[model samples]
Target: MFPFPPSLPPVATESAEDLAEQSEIEYGTLEGGSTMAFFRDSKIETYQKMWRYMESKRPSVFVPTIEEGVKRVLEGNYAFLMESTMLDYTIQRNCNLTQVGGLLNSNSYGIATPIGSPWRDKISLAILELQEKGIIQMLYSKWWKNTGDVCNRDEKNKDSKANALGVENIG
Candidate 1:
C-alpha cells in the first residue's frame, strides 16, 4: 500500500498532447522511442493509437501490468498510458504517482457476456434496474468516492486563482 495525497489537485490531468510533449522532453529525446507502459494485448483502440503515435517517433516499451507501469513511472523518465479508471485508482493508492494529462478518449464500463448467451438480456436488465434504483451509483460512491482513504480536493476557488509562475507551469 502507498500513502495517499493530503489534498487532491483540481484537475486530474492536462491535455494529452501536453503530457506527451512533456514526457518526451523528460526522457531526453522525442525521436527515440521512450518507454511507456500499457496493458499487454489491450483491446482498447486508444492503446493502439498511442502505440502507433509513439512508435512513429520512437519505439515504446510496453509492459504487462499497471504495477509495472507505476514502477517505471516512479523510477522516473517514463509515462504510463492507461484507462482513466486505472489511472485514478493507482493515483489514489500512491502519493508519488499522479495523472499527467486529460483523457485521450472516453469509454463506458460494461458487463461482458458470451455472444448469444441467454443470460445476457437478464444480466443487462438487472444492471439497468440497479442503475435506475440508484444501487449502482451508491456502490460506485461507496467504493470510489466515500472510501475515506482517497484524498479530497477543495474546488471552491479552482477557477478564480491566478496561475502560479513556475518553470514547470510555463511549459
Candidate 2:
C-alpha cells in the first residue's frame, strides 16, 4: 500500500453542508439547485471514474516547462478534453480574465511543454497583460524591478483596489 506523500498538504475538514456549497460554487449552480440531482443521476459517476483514470499519473512525467504545458494542453487529446470542460464551465459562469489567469497558472502542469510559435505569441501577450496588471511578478532576474513596475501598473488597473487590499487579496 502507498503511504500518503509528505509533500501533500493536510486535507481540510468540511461539513456536508459546506461541501455542498463548495460544489455548487465550483459548478456554477444556484444553492439547492437541481445540479446536485444531476450528479446523482449516474453520468457523474462515470465522469468521476474517467477523471480518476486520467489523473492517475503525474503530467510532469511527460512535459517539463510552462511552454510545454501550453503545447500539450492545446494539442493533446486528454488535455483538450479537460480544457474544453473547464472552458465551458468558465463561459457558463461568465468568469473574467483573472479567473482564466488563475486556471492557466494552476493547470500549467497539465500542458507544460515546448509551445508552438503562434500559441507562444498569444501566451506572450497574455503574460504581458498579466504582468502589467501585477498579477504575476518576475524574480531572480536583472530586469525584475522594471518588469515589476510595468506589471504593477497593469495590476492596478485590472484590480481597482489591489494596492489598498493588502497581502490577503493575492490569488
Candidate 3:
C-alpha cells in the first residue's frame, strides 16, 4: 500500500525499480519526482538487497513494522512493500490504502493429514471441488474482502487481478 489520499489519481506499479527510478513521487506528482519508499527490513538477502537499492539511490525506505510503514504511507509520499497476506489484510480495512498491481511472486499452502490416512484424499478432493465450483473464492470475497471497516471508498470487487501486483520486495 502506497499512500495517496483517496482523492488523488492512482500511481500504481509492480516494480521496485519503477518506484525508485520513477520516484514514489517527490511529493504527489511525477514531473520532478524522486524516490519515496519504505522497506520491510527483513533478514532475507533479497529484501536486504532491495532495501540497499533504495537507500543507495534514494532516502532510506526501511520500517520495522507494518504499523510504522502504514503510518508513514498515510502521511503521504511513500510505498510500503511487504508480504502480501498481511498487507492485503491491512488494505481491506482502510479505504486510503489500495494494492496497485499483481503478484510479484507467490507460494502455495496445503492441508496436512497422517500418512495414507483416508481423510487426506477426502480433504484434498473436497478442496478441489470447492475450488472448481468457486466456493472457496466466494468465501474469500465474503470474509476477507467485504468483512472490513473501511472508509466509504468505491465498493467494487476486491480480487487480486493478474496485472502488476506491485513491488513485493518492498510491500
Model-by-model lDDT, in order? 0.50, 0.30, 0.55
TM-score of 1: 0.57
lDDT of 1 by residue, 9-95 (tens): 332224433333343422111222122433123344444555556566454445555666567667655555566666666676565
By summed lDDT, which 10 consecutive residues of candidate 2 come out lowest? 1-10
* Quality of model 2 by C-alpha lDDT: 0.30
What TM-score would every model get versus the actual structure?
0.57, 0.19, 0.59
TM-score sort, best first: 3, 1, 2
Top TM-score hit: 3
Report, for all candidates in order, the number of backbone clashes: 4, 13, 13
Q: Model 1: residues >4 Å from true position, as ranges? A: 1-13, 22-53, 56-60, 114-117, 153-171
Of 1 and 3, the candidate ahead on lDDT is 3
Cα lDDT tens digits, model 2, 49-155, are 42333234334323333234334433322122223233333223321211221211112322243756467667777777977977764432334344333222244
**lDDT tens digits, residue span 1-171, model 3:** 244344433555444344545544432211112212223334545445555565554444555566777776787776665556666677778766766544444546798888989999899999999999999989977877777564455547443322353344534
